[model samples]
Target: MGFNNWNSTHCRAEFNESMVKGIADTFVAQGLKDAGYTYVNIDDCWALPDRNASGDLVPDPARFPHGIKAVADYVHSKGLKFGLYSSAGTKTCDVQGFPGGLGHERQDAELWASWGVDYLKYDNCNNTGADAKQRYKAMGDALAAATRATGRPILYSICEWGSNQPWTWAQGVGNSWRTTGDISDNWSSMISIAHQNQSLAPYAGPGAWNDPDMLEVGNGGMTDTEYRTHFSLWSQMAAPLLIGSDLRTASPATLAILKNTEVIAVDQDPLGRQGTVVSDSGGLVVMSKPLADGGRSVTLTNETSSTRTVSTTVKDIGIGGASSYALKDLWSKATSTTTGAIGAPVPAHGTVMFRVTPGSPVPPPTGVNQLSDLPWTSAVGGWGPVERDRSNGEQAAGDGRPLTIGGVRYAKGLGTHAPSDIAYYLGGGCSALRVDVGVDDEAPNTGSVRFQIWRDGTLAADSGVRTAADPPVRLNADLKGATKLRLVVTDGGDGITYDHADWADARLACGSGPSAGTHELSDLAWESATNGWGPVEKDLSNAEQAAGDGTPLTINGTVYAKGLGTHAPSSVAYYLGGTCTSLTTRVGVDDEVTTKGSVDFQIWRDGTLAAESGTLTSADAAKALTADLTGALEVRLVVTDAGDGIDYDHADWAGPRLVCG
Candidate 1:
């Protein structure tokens, strides 16, 4: 089950001018010959309606004058493979209710094999999740059976819409699988698909590659930088490079980039280690794949809509031991050697691919071999920041007052279960971070424990925590600049002990942020909860009462101030109660707390100053302060902290309920 180097597609129909003269086939032949990209595929719209009354597959007599057989022969004549498309269920992706291959899979496979079809891209549009694996295996087995029946070795390509991890089973059934949706001719769409493929690299192998739908290289809209990133990531992910563009009109620059053998060699490396994202920041990502000849292929991609510099060292990709290496730029055909590491300039949505050939021999493996070696600690009581210097630490909350873990106790409770802080690779140039915490069976109370991260005192991400204890709590963050990371656990409604927390094992994906022409935080859920001053049912189940915005209502204790999102002290003032008699909540941005952009604070009762714009302060009780003076004041706290030159930092709403004299 050895995998081939490249599986290319020429999506001529992707253009407005559906049909091409001889140029479509000619361009494909050239790509297959020059670029070493096999499988000159004909995408949708190549066939006409069903010709036979029995509803058999047929080719468009006008588009394919010599019929499907002739096209296959032409492709074979160019020393390239020929592929076709079909549906496993009812309709194809193009909305045509094509005959399903599920019922007549064998028959259809036989017909295609007889017609000299070398590969098949079986799609899943109208397909349901009725035993996805079984259905896919059925088609794959049918294809094999057809090959045996017709004496042809037609390769099967499964396209199940990425419902499940097809790579886990697709290799047994087909040659490759689609891990993402269809590709469009835009930078955002291309980078997005590429990033998704990066995470599933370990599942990709020779006969089973992750298909990021197809390529949009020669297509319009995307720039040269974007195309480079697209090609670089696809190559590193070990994905099938199926081109979805008008090859005839492709610019010379595009031709050169695609034809670069050095870059393509990285893609075709026999070692077949799928690239993984190392780190990400400000729309930039660092990815690396092991090469066959004891080297690595690194790609620095800037998925931001604007150009940015993505600096990274080889050490960031678990290659710190490599003292010296030669970096061969795939796009520029330039070479540079360094003793330390290297950084490259990345255009907006662009990438820089390099062949990192180590100069030294292999070293013995040391330390934890697997990613799960790092220890994870659960938030003991109400999750929040705990001031623990080391193993000899104090504990907070419940019977587990002095919560012990491996002979260590975290005073200040298990610092809020921040998802963003859980998964981060410090000193690495990666973006998205995830942290997992194993919860104990001795469930006390459960409430939403929202995790908030501050980088250099700026809010990074406000992640939501799950109530269930089956799976450990998860905190994820996408830090954009501001190196130092901080976690803030707003509130855990109940008192459940988190046993272990896993951190720093994730990376940021490309194009994950809201694109241009769209409002930031527009998709965030906003609601109002007032006049229902209800007693709080604190537990992991109702964690939102402890965390802000997890639910509609804000829980106010008799004399305690509930935690909310971290905010800068200078720009914000939490006004509790009504306008006239409300308490003021203030934040001071300075030294430890660097603020950025706008800040939002809510009293929960009145929608006063939900978000304010201006330079923020990070000063503690020093300069930023506000008092709650309204009658029946509940809880007031800061929510959002934007980082566009504004400081954001250690924020908490303080209140002590009045005692009746």
Candidate 2:
């Protein structure tokens, strides 16, 4: 963990030698050094816009009157590391066009090392459209040579902005790679970057990280709750937590967030495992990072505008076989106990972090259940997140409609695109898995897919090839005594386009009977409803200001027939009677408005916000929204005008369903 000036000061006049020195001083005086934030890095504009007579970068005489080495020496005097920034191109990103290290990688590396620089935040601007890997690797090789020649180790950071999939090849090239564009001090920017970085967890570990840009904790654009979520997610992603705010003026709340030792420990854990998303339905997301000491750091993120009860199971986080677990809230410092279930009431745009330690060993759950109800060890979908109890709509999670194959809908199963792999921990308990597999009817006549069931390392069942014209084929896999179960779907000797696949009515017979199922929300009667333009329409989009003047619900080109559609500033309520366990749906601005509408979708359990869609426009694709309604008496679907005028704000709650007993 360290501090960088770009996000706060940027190329402003205050980014001078005295500011750098003051940062180092603040790090020592404010217990930041004790919290392990060492590096005091300066971003662009630290040097002159042009090179010197001998082709050497010259420090800006006005900004660093004493010289770059002097600032480095002062930082070292404080027992802190110093970092500098440059671009791989001919010029830095600033409008002043500062000279970069494009053809002078070796020269710049040696110069920075001579000045006692320990970290380099290489940028991506002015690259002249060269191959990303080649350009980045040139600097990587130069840094290695400089380290050997100068006998000084410098951490090389690749800032290519994921233009060329650097995570697949940046292992030895740099200590970290930027996985997304620069982040702003807002909830949408921070959370969207987190979402982009979370899927690449497998590419991150010790000595190599996925950089999602710098921290915006102390930035004034967002609330403290949102900043905590940002910090929690960054730590969980194993990202380099370079503080992006001005430390001299940082508030106590910001310092507390930056110095949370419990949270930092998860990032610095020797296991070096980046947290993986355990479940992300609606805006409630659960991430689990395996700790070095056999514990797990769990982050329950509420990305909506209201509070929610985000939850996950011990087995879901790759840990179980324990009767109980000790849960320590990393943020609140509260301790609790859980019998496999881990959850909390997280505030809107907040995260509840916990370090869970198993208390005693025990067997895993053995009840017969729908596979969608269980947690997968790993799930990679070709298009979007794997959907539960829906067809693979090839859009966002929960965007899929009911699990339909050959025009028949099944109430429970998994929805996946081609080239998907979902694995679950069976713990040698499941005796069999029965599922009807087929290419989803949504892609009928245009797609083909193959399905395979793997029991541990052995192939238990395989469907050669199934096309849309074919009916649902039942696959019974003998998973008796298997510790793991993997469901694989591949493109059927063709490209992946339109290859939506389904595992319909997937039931696993483990320790008991009675598998779970879901009911479509459109098929259920609503307790009450109101709309901005007209009555809420069932299984259709609100085309006109009338009850039945509607058409098939469509968002970003995908069509659905089973959902509620209404204008913005609308409310639709359903009575659950505390029987439903979850409600999953995809929400977006209905395509009836083309690209001219904006709206926000929210799920309210009783009176509290359970999930939210942030702000979505007609140009955006459908987004997943889920809520855990374990004991909810009533659930409400709400759509607002997104703080803008309500013109053309036709919102659709696409393919909403509730898992109830």
Candidate 3:
């Protein structure tokens, strides 16, 4: 951990020799040096705009009148390290166009080594279209040679802005690689950069790390809550915590956040394992980092504007078999214990971090259960958090509606976007899993997703490709003797646009089948029915005025074997008898009309309008509709013409299903 002047002073007039010396002195005065902050780095504009007659870099006369070596000597005299900035291109990033260390890599390295420089922030600017790896490696090799000649190691920081994925190749070339663009002193900028850097956990470790720009903790652009989140997330990600604010003017709150030794321990841990996302539904995120000890550092972040309860389980964080776990609040220094769950009410733009130590080992629980009712080992989503009994709306948690797939609503299931993986520790107790999977109807007809079930890393079941237009496809996997179960969703050869996928009615049969039952609406007897043009047909589309005259139920060119097909101004009522919990279906103008019809669909629960689909046309895709039927005696499905007359207003309720005890 250290401090950099770029974010605070950035080429300003105040970035002089005295400022550098003051920072080093303040590091000693402010207890920062004792707390592990050593380096005081100078960024761009430190050097003159031109090279000297001997092709050597010259310190700017006004900024560093006594020269760069003098500043380095002062920092070293305080028992602190010094860092300088240069670019891999012809000039630095500043508008002043200062000379860079591109062709003079060896010379610059040797020059900085002689001046007691211990770190180099190599930037990317004005490069002459050369390969990124080659350019960065040149300076890396030069720094290695400088260390050998001077017997002083220099930390190389590559600032390529992730335009080239340095994480794939920067190991052994630089100590850390910039994984994103420059970070502004704002919550949006910091959190967005954190999201970009969170997924590359595998590339970060002891010697090599992912640099998501510098810390903006005390920059005043965000609240203290947001600043804590910034610090906690950076430390959790094992990022180089280079303070970007001016220490001389830093607030006590900023110093407290920066000097939280418990948090610093997570960053400076010997194992250096970067935390990985355990779950991110909506904006409530949970990350877990394994420490050198058997314990873990967990971070629960609230990215929303409102305070929310963010939570996870010890088993989810890769620690289990403990009778109870000790949780040390890294910021508050408060200690608590839990059997397995770790959670807290986090503030807006805030984070709750903990150092968790597992208790004595014990046997895990085992029984037939819904996966949602049980804690998962880990979960990672593409767009939003992996939800329970809700669709992946790609927003904040619980912002999604009921889990509806191709019009079938599931009262119990997982709602996740594509490129998601959710795991559970079965402990060889589960025998099988039965689930209905599909791209959620929320995506309309635009999504294509693949569902997979893995047992102990072996692919047990796979749904080839389920699109938004397809009905729910059921998969039954024999997970007998397997210790782990993983539910995975992929982009199905297509991109992940609008890929809201669902694992509907997922039942884990450890000792028996699911607790509740489900039934298709078309298979149930209706209490009453009325049609505008013909008798309502079962498992078919409305073709003419006669019953059974319609073909298979079809909407937006996608066919379904089960659903109620009728004309506009029609009503179909089912006697739910207060047994069912919810009704889910996709409603649209039947493709039989071929872009020449418009109608409105509505769902009524005992005379109350529960859900509606405003004005759907043959040209539009099917719309997902859901209604709560809990404790209701009857449910109604109604369709009407769009006030333009019932011309070709053939409507279909596609893949309607009801969940009941």
Candidate 4:
């Protein structure tokens, strides 16, 4: 996060005159302030080695030769705000040469105010286990008093990293509080921070926001796709948009991602509603945020490596009634209409962000079978304590549950020996439900655990019994008359012991009642991506994986798309269906790129040419590319060189895995 950039791309003493000037210029030149990225902050190591003779902090002359006031003035001239950083400890982090605001709270606040500092990122490091509330409150009060006297209202940000769980008491102490530690620029780090942020949803809003560190967009640590996911997650949760990279040297792709206006609107939404995880199955999670205009901001992310087909429905997002919403993809700006379900192929460590505008309501299809797009509702049965709070009435995880060795993440919440039920909001759409249930490694094997899914009051599905070593069991059963599902676990022939169970990858597949076109196939599986072999991508439309005409990519020969460059000869495979017979794809070189790469388009059915677009060049217009399924079990789209291998050739296969026959 980072205004200071932490240890990213810069060094401790790198905060200097040339650096601030360059950053200020970039802020204005890059339209950062105009795009709502208003604050330009310089973090730790900016101050002198120690306090001045008058007990006031000073910017290092060698670093900020003209002083911080000059820098603040320059930043102000850019029509943006200027921020500075310090700590609440005895000394700031890397204290060897930096001073902290231990006894200099008022002096520092007034100094910053006099210097026109509009923001303060007060950190907590090496502070020991001192009374955090009192320490932070002193800084907050000092800053407030400075504002009243100096006529400059500094936005106070508490970088406590949730050590004392600041969300519970930091409302009046800071404008935003760091809910997690410094975020490294990677998928796992981002996802882990996101998971913690999701649990703190109730603590975020306007003015008083939950800070998940800062943006790592231009850090070059993650792919642009993963960066999109990271950005979308932070915005959905109403976190502060602190730029942490060197904006002056940001790539065009990175800038495009950071300055996505539509997605930014979600973050700056006046309502300040924070989204939460509505569905998590097989590590594929869906986060839904309620926007101000009765619209919703939804992010579908894949945590597992390789590719995944992630799906969710309107009902899962808190929208009701059968309706087709105009789904606007924030990344690609592509819009589509779907009944209620949204099924798209998401690359590994990637995400699909959508701003769904409510469209015409209709009676959903009612005569086919498909997976339920609605999210599940969870409830725990019996016992509380240890992991549960009594006096505070808080939503604690295994807080008070007895004999609990440690907390385990279950369908409802984290706990073992749970008789918990995970109910799906099928909205009367699903006719059957299928789910895999298992006992996690946390199980102590103290007793047998019985897993069962009850449809209303009847037993719809059941996994007889399981021990610690047993893998997850699949429970497939009818759900037509079910009102709610109970994921009940019984302590077999013993008292409540270590009976940990999980409903892993639980799904409500359509069983005979969804209308035609209302349900898209959600049962398809995706293999991992291979560099030379390539991988099939899925989306309603993706400039990264689509022809310029906003159509599915045809992989016949070399072609050029927006994100993917011109290719050499390559082939990718996909599983259409058991009875698949025909394939339809919108294929051609994206009209945007000027490259005229030569490519041979051929579809191999069981290793033979099922269809061929003989020796094509980039001049050709986009058209329907089809391959006859005919007795073929495995199909591969072969993209080879027509003349030379591939130069600026990018071909995409969009839409679904394959349109079933």
Candidate 4 per-residue lDDT, tens place, 1-661, comes to 2244553544456557777778778766777666787777888888777888998898888888899999999889977788898999888876364888867899889999999999998989867667889889999999999999989999999999988899878987889999998888877898899898886765566688888888888798899888888888888888887777877678998889888888899989886767767677888988777676657888998988989999998765656443467898898888898777876899988889999776633322332212223332323332221121111112333333222222333232223344343344444444554555565555566646777777766887767777766665667777664554555676554544555555543434332311223112222332212222233333312233433323433444434232222243656554432235666554544443455655666677544587776655667665456777643344566656676755655444433224444
Q: Residues 462-539, candidate 1, lDDT per residue (tens digit)?
A: 545544343444455554342333444433443223422222222222112212231211122222222111212211
Decreasing TM-score order of the candidates: 2, 3, 4, 1
How do all models score by TM-score?
Answer: 0.53, 0.59, 0.58, 0.56
Candidate 3 has an lDDT of: 0.86
* Candidates 1 and 4, the one with greater lDDT: 4
lDDT of 4 at 458: 80
In candidate 1, position 244 carries an lDDT of 59
Pitting candidate 3 against candidate 4, the one with the higher lDDT is 3
Off by over 4 Å in 3: 363-661
Q: What is the lDDT of residue 443 in candidate 3?
A: 91
| Greater-TM-score candidate between 1 and 2 | 2
- Compared with the true structure, all predictions reach lDDT values of 0.51, 0.86, 0.86, 0.65
In model 3, where is the ten-residue run with the lowest total lDDT?
360-369
Q: Per-residue CA lDDT of candidate 2, range 267-309, in tens?
A: 8899787887868899999988878666789999998888889
State the local distance difference test value for candidate 2.
0.86
Model 4 regions more than 4 Å off: 1-4, 7-10, 95-97, 360-661
